[model samples]
Target: MKQATAKVSHRLRGAQGGMEGRFRLVLVVVMAGVTLFVLGRGLFEAPDAPDTFVNGTSTSPGGHRALLHLLDEEGFTVTSSVDRLDVLNENDFQDPEAALALLEPSPQFLDKYESEVRGLFSRSWRPPLILVLPKRHYHALQSDEDGTLVLQEGIYSIDDSERVLQLAGLGSELGVRRVTGGDVIEPDSPYATRIHDESDEAQVLEFTSAASPWRKLITDSRNRTLAAVNPLTRVVVLAEPDLISNRFLDQGDSAALARHVFEASQCRHLVVDEALHGMATRASLEYLAVRPPALWALLSVLLLLALFAWREATVLRTQPAEVDARRSREFVIEGVARLMLRAKDFRMAAQHLQQRAPLALLPSRAHVHAAGVAGSTSASLPGEVAERLHQLPENDGSEEHLIRVARRVAEIRREVSLSHHVPSARKPG
Candidate 1:
C-alpha cells in the first residue's frame, strides 16, 4: 500500500513539471512573434518625404506662412500666384493694393509671360510689386545695354554675373574657388544674410544671372543697389530669396530685415518672378533632406541584438566552492599570527589571545611573570603560552610562541602599573 501511494505522488509531480515547461514555451513563442512583426513593419514601410514647407503649406520659404499669418492677424486677405495678368485683373489695375509675386526658373514662364508682366505696369493705377529672383534662374530674363534690366524708369538693375544674376551685388562671385570646394558667398555680406553652409556658400537671392538681360540699378561694396523706386509704384528688388525662406526666417535678423523692407516699400502688390521658384524649391528641399543609414550599420546592430538574446537563453550555472577541512584551522591560526607580527602591537595581541582561547588561563601567567619569581616558570604563565615559547608543540609551536609573547607583554604592563616611582629594571645581561 505504501509503495502504491509513493508512485502516485511521483506521477503527479511529473505532470506539474510538464505543464510549467509548456507555459514557458508559449511565452517565448509570443515574444518572438512580436519582435518579427515590428522588424517587418520597419523594413517594409516607405520613407517620409522631405519637409520642404513649414507647417505643411506655403510653396516657397521666407516665412510665407508666418507672413500670411501676420496678414491674417492684421485683417488683410493674402493671395498668391505666378500670373501677372491675374494679379492686374484682380486689383482691376485701379485700386492700389500690395502683392508679392514668386518666380520659378522655367523658360516657358519667362518667355511667354513677358507681355502680361509688362502690362502690370502699363496703367497709372497699380499696386506695389516685390520681385524675388534666385541666382539659378536670374539669367533667363531679358536685359538692355549697361547691364541693367529696368522694369520702369525709376526701377533698374545694378550688378550682373555669369553664374548667378547679380541683384545689387548680394551674393558671392560666381565660379569663385573655395579651399574646401565650391564658391561660397560670405554670410556677413550686407546683401547676403543667413548663409546655410559655410563650406559652400551658395547664395540664395532674388537676382538673376548674366545670361539673362536683367539690368542693375544700384551698386555698393556691401549690397548691389538695384532698381530705384518709381516714387509712384514703390517697387523694391531684393537680391537673396533666403531673406524670406522658412529656414532663414529666424536667422541673422532676417525676419526683422524683411519686415523693414516690406513696411518701408508700402507696396500693396508683390510680383514674384516665377522663374526663380524651382531653384528656391530645390535649394530648400536640399537643405531639409537627410541621407539614409548604411546597410552595414543596420546589419551590425541586428547582429549584436541576436547575440545578446542567444546568450540570455543559453546561460550556464556557476559551480559552488568546495570545502577543505584539513587546511581550515591552519589557515585561521596563520592569518592571526601574520596580523600580530605585522602590527607589532603586543597589547592588542594579548587581547586577541584572551578572546580566541577562553579555556587558557593567561592572566595567572602574566601575574607570575610580573612578580619576578625565578623557578616559578611552571606557574609563570598559562601552559599554552609556555609551550609556545619553548617550541614544544611540534606543528603547533608557532601559535604557542605568539601567545607567549602576548602574555609577556601583559606582565610588563602590570609591572609598570604596580610601581609608580621605581624605574623598571632591564632584562638580565
Candidate 2:
C-alpha cells in the first residue's frame, strides 16, 4: 500500500513539473513582448527642440520667441493669431490696452494679403501695430539618422522690400539698406532700457531712410535712422529684429531692451501674428499626416487595443454546460446487441428479446376478472399482444429461426397498434 501511495505522489510531482515549465515559458514570452515595446518607443519618439520661431513655443537660442515670453512675464496677456485677416474683426484687436506685432512676415505674405492689413486700419478703435521686417532666409533640411527635417539658415535682405513697404501703406518713405557699421541705439530714450548690446559696437540693423510723418527712434554710429514710428497709423517699424530675436535676446541686457519695446506700446495685451509663419495651415497638417513612422505607430496602437478588448470579452463569457454522462435506453440496446453478437450467444439474445418486450405488452385483465372487479370482460391490447407473441415458433439458436421469430413479433406489434386506440385517444372530447 505504501509503495502504491509513493507512486501516486511521484506522478503528481511530474504533472506539477510540467505546469511549472509551461509557466516559465509564458513569463519569458511576456518579458520579450515588453522589451519589444520599449525598443519601439525609443526608436519612434519625436524630437523636441528648445528653440523655434513657431508661436506659443518656448524662446530658443535661434528664434524671436523670447519677446513673447518676456511680454508674458510682464503680466501682459499675449495671444497668437493663426487666422487670416478676412476672418478677424475689431473684437479680435479690441482690448483697451492692446498692441499688435507682425514678426518677420514674408514679403510674399504681405503682398498676397494686403487687404487684411487694410481691414485692421479701417477699424475705429485703432491699436498700435509694429512691423518687424524679415532679414534671413532659412531652408529646412532632412536629418539622416531620424529622417527628421531641421532648418538650415542663411541671412539676406528680403526678396522684395519695396512691395512689403507698399503693402504696409508706408511706401519708399521707409527704405531698407544693409548696414556695415556697429550697434545703433538711443540709451537715453525712455523706450531704451539700460541693456546695451555686447561690445556696445557690433554689426547691427540700422535704418537708411527716415522720411516726414515718421519719427526716427534710433540711429547708427553713421547717424542713419534704425527705428521709426508713423503716428498717423500708429505703426512702429524696427529695421533689425535682432534685439528681440532669440539668439541676441540673452546677450547684454537684450531682455531689458525687449521689455522696453513692450513697455513703449503701453498696452495690456500683445498679439503675435503666426499666420505668416507657415503654421495652422492645411498644408502643414497634410505634411504631418504623410510621415510614415507617425502613421504606422497610430495604426499599431489601435490594433493592439482591439485585440485586448476581444480577449477580455472571451475570458468573461460563461462556458457551455457539461454533456450528460448516463447512456440512453437505445444506446443500451445497441450495446447489448453488439456484445451478444461478439460472444455468438444467439439463444441468450432471443431470450433477452422475449423478456424485454412481452412483459410490458401483457395486461392484468384475467387477474382482475378472477377477482370479480372488471367492468369489461375483454383483455387489453397488451394481453392480446402477449398471447400472439407466445404463439410464434421458438428460436433453436439458429440464425434462420431467430430471424423468423423476430419478424413475427414485429408484425404482431404493428397489427395490435393499428387495431386498438390508446385509452386517452378513445375518450370523447
Candidate 3:
C-alpha cells in the first residue's frame, strides 16, 4: 500500500510540473502572437475608428450588439442616441413613445451632462428610463478596417457607480454596492431566475442602501436586489450589465430576462446611448499595446525564452562534418527528384519532370499558326505534355511501378532538354 501511494504521488507531482511547463509555453506563444498583432495593427491602421462600447455597434463580449439585434428581430424599431440630452428633449416623451437606455456612462459624462440627464429623467411626462450600470474599466484594443474600436478583457472596478445613481436622482432611494469574492449569481425568487447566472465567472452586484419602496426585479443569491423598478418615477435600474450584454445574453435565461425588462419599459421605440462611451477619438495601436505592466510582462517572457535558448546551446555534442559551401540549382533539383523517387510518389515526380522539360521540344505558336492547319494542329507543348501523361500505363500503383513511371518521365524530360537550344537547367555551370 505504501509503495502504491508513493508511486501515485510521484506521478501526480510529475504531471503537475508538466502542466506548469505547458502553461508557460502557451503563455509565451500568446504573448508573441499579441506582439505581432499589435505591431501589424500599428503599421496598417486607418485614421477614423468606430465605437465598440454598448453602443450596439459590436458583438464582442463587452458590447450590446446582441441585445440590439434581438430587439430588432422582435419587431421593435431600435434607434441610437449619438447626441446629448438635446435629442431626448426633442422627442415626444409624454405618450411614452420611446424608452431611453442609459448604458454604462462614465463619471465624466455624468458630470458634464448632469442637468440634461436630470431634465430628461426627472420629467413626469417623459418615457421610461432604464439605467444599466457599468462594472469595469476597459481599454479599447484593435480597430476594424473601417476603424471600429473593439473592447474586451477589461479590468473590473466598481468605482463611480454611485455617482451614476446620483446623476439619475436615485442616490437617495438606492445605492450601488459591490461585493468581492463572489462567482456565480444565484436568485432568491422564481422571477429572479430570468436573469440567472450560468457563467461561473459572473460578477456580483450588491445594494448598500436601505430598502426602498421600489419593486425588486432580480436579486443576488443573498436576496440583495440587483434590479429594481420605481413605478412612480417610471425608472428602472439594472445593477449588473452582463445580463443584457453580449457576453451573457444567450447564457441561461438572460435573453428572456432582457426582453422582459424592455417590455416593462412600455415603449415601442427605444434609444441606446452611444455619446457617453467616448467615441470621439480614434483608437490607435499604441493605446492598446503600450501599457506599463503589459510591456514589462512581454519583456520578462522574451528574456526567459532567450535564456532557455542560450542554455540549450551550451550542451556538448559531436562536431558535425562540413560539406561544400555552394551548389548549383541543378544539384538541388536532382536531390529533390531523388527524395521524391524514394517516397514512391510517381505522379508527383513525373509532373515535376514535365514542368522542367525544355520548351524547344514543342512547336512554336507562330509556326503553328503560319501552317494554317489550325483544326489539325493539336501539337502545342501543353497538349503534348497532357498526352504523354495520359499514355502512362495503369498499374497496381505499387512502389516499383511508381519508380518505373518516374524513370520514364525523367528520360522524356532529358531528351527534350537535349533537343532544346535553351540553356539546360541540369548543366554543370
Candidate 4:
C-alpha cells in the first residue's frame, strides 16, 4: 500500500511537469511553423511600386489594362515585361507575330532609353511597336481617412507627349483638338475600316500633325491625326491615350476601337512594356531580401526573433529537476532521520531501535557459535546481546547518540548475516 501511494504521488508530479514541457514544445513548434510560412511568402511577394502607373498590369484610371483584358476576352493572349527593350530577345519579347505595346510611357523613359530603343527597332526581326503617348500622370498621397495612399491626377504637359512622338521619328506636335461641328471624324485614308466609334460627337482626342511617310490611319474631325503608322519601321503611334485608358475604355465603342486597333496589327499576341513605368521583376533571393516587400519580411523575422528571445528568458527556462523515483537505502535513512529531527521526538526513534535491538539481532559471539550448536538453541544468546546493548551509553536521541546507535546496529546486522550463511555442526553424535 505504501509503495502504491508513492507511485501515485510520483505520477501526479510527473503529469504536471509533462504538461508544462509539452505546452512549451507545442508553442515553439507552432511559432516556428508560422514564422517559416510568413518568411517563405514575403520572400517572394514583392509588390509593384507606384500603384497608379500606366501599365497593363495596373487597374488604375490612367492604366490601359482594361484594353488588354478586352483583348483577352476576344481570344488574344497578353503578356507584359519590365525588361529593357534593347536586351529583349524572342524569349523575353517574342516573335514577329507578337506586338510590343508601349501604353502611356513616360517621356523621360523614352529620352533616356532613346539609343537603346532605336537600336531595338532597327532589328529586321523586331516585333511591331505600338507607342501610345502619355495623357495624364498621378501623384500618390496619404489620405485623411487612413494612412493608405490615394492617387490624384495631375496636368500632363503636352511637350512630354511631343517629345516621345518625335523620338518615334514622327516629326509632329501632339495637342488636344475637338471637332468644330460634330464628333464624327472622317477617315480619309486606307485601313479606315478599323474605326469603331459609336459617338456622334467626337470627344476631343490628342492629335498629331502627322504627314507624308506617316500615314494617318485614324483621325478626329477636321482631319486631325489621332493615329498613324510608319510603314517602313512597322511602328504605330496613337496620340490619344484616353481612348484606351481604364477610365474611358468602357465608353461607347471604345472597347471595339481598342480591339480593332490590336486585331488590325496582324500580331498574334500583345506584350505591354512595363519597364517604362518602373515595375522590374527580379525573383533572386538577394533581390527578394531587399526589394519592395523586404521591409515587411524583415519586420516579421524580427518579431519572430523577439518571441524566441522572450521564450528563452521566461517560458522556456529550465525548472528544478524532480528527485529520482527509486529511493536509495542511504537516502531513506537520512530522510527518516530528518523527519525525526523535525518532529522534535528523537526519543521516538531511539526507543524503536532499543526494542528491536536484542529481539531482532543475533549475539555477536553466537553468530558462528550457533553453527557449532546444530540442533541446540542458545539459551545465553539473548542475555549476551541485551547486556551488550544495555552497557552502551544511553541514547539521548541527539545526533551523536544516533551515530553510535547506527554503528551498533551495523555490527548486529553483520553477525546475523554470518549466522545465516555458516554451516551447522553435526549433532554430538
lDDT of 4 by residue, 1-429 (tens): 877877787788779888977886777778778766666775566554544467787777888778888888888878888777777646844465888888887765666578766677557677888877786788776776867657888746666766665665554433433333323233643322222345422223343444455666566545666666667776777767766888877765667666655665678688888867766453445446555577677677768777875765476545543344346677888998788678976566766776677667754456567666444336675676667667779778676776677687778678756664667566776
Q: TM-score winner between 2 and 4, please give it.
A: 4
Q: Summarize candidate 1's per-residue lDDT along 246-340 as a digit string, tens digits.
A: 55666655555555445445644443333223222222222222223444554565576667557656876343222343247888799888986
Candidate 4 residue pairs in clash (backbone atoms < 3 Å)? 183-201, 183-202
**Which residue pairs show backbone clashes in model 2?**
51-60, 63-246, 97-268, 207-226
Best of the two (3, 4) by TM-score:
4
TM-scores of all models?
A: 0.31, 0.48, 0.46, 0.49
lDDT (C-alpha) at residue 405 in model 2: 60
Candidate 1 RMSD to the real structure: 22.8
Q: lDDT of each structure?
A: 0.43, 0.60, 0.63, 0.66
Candidate 1 structure lDDT: 0.43
lDDT of 2 by residue, 217-336 (tens): 565545566566766767777766666777777765567656655665667687777766654232333234435666577567657755664564465533322122124566778998
- Candidate 3 runs further than 4 Å off: 1-52, 87-89, 92-95, 142-152, 180-211, 279-429
Candidate No. with top lDDT: 4
**Which candidate, 1 or 4, has the higher TM-score?**
4
Let me know the TM-score candidate 3 reaches against the reference structure: 0.46
Ranking, lDDT, top scorer first: 4, 3, 2, 1
CA error at residue 130 for candidate 4, angstroms = 0.7
Query: Roughly what TM-score does model 1 have, to 2 decimal places?
Result: 0.31
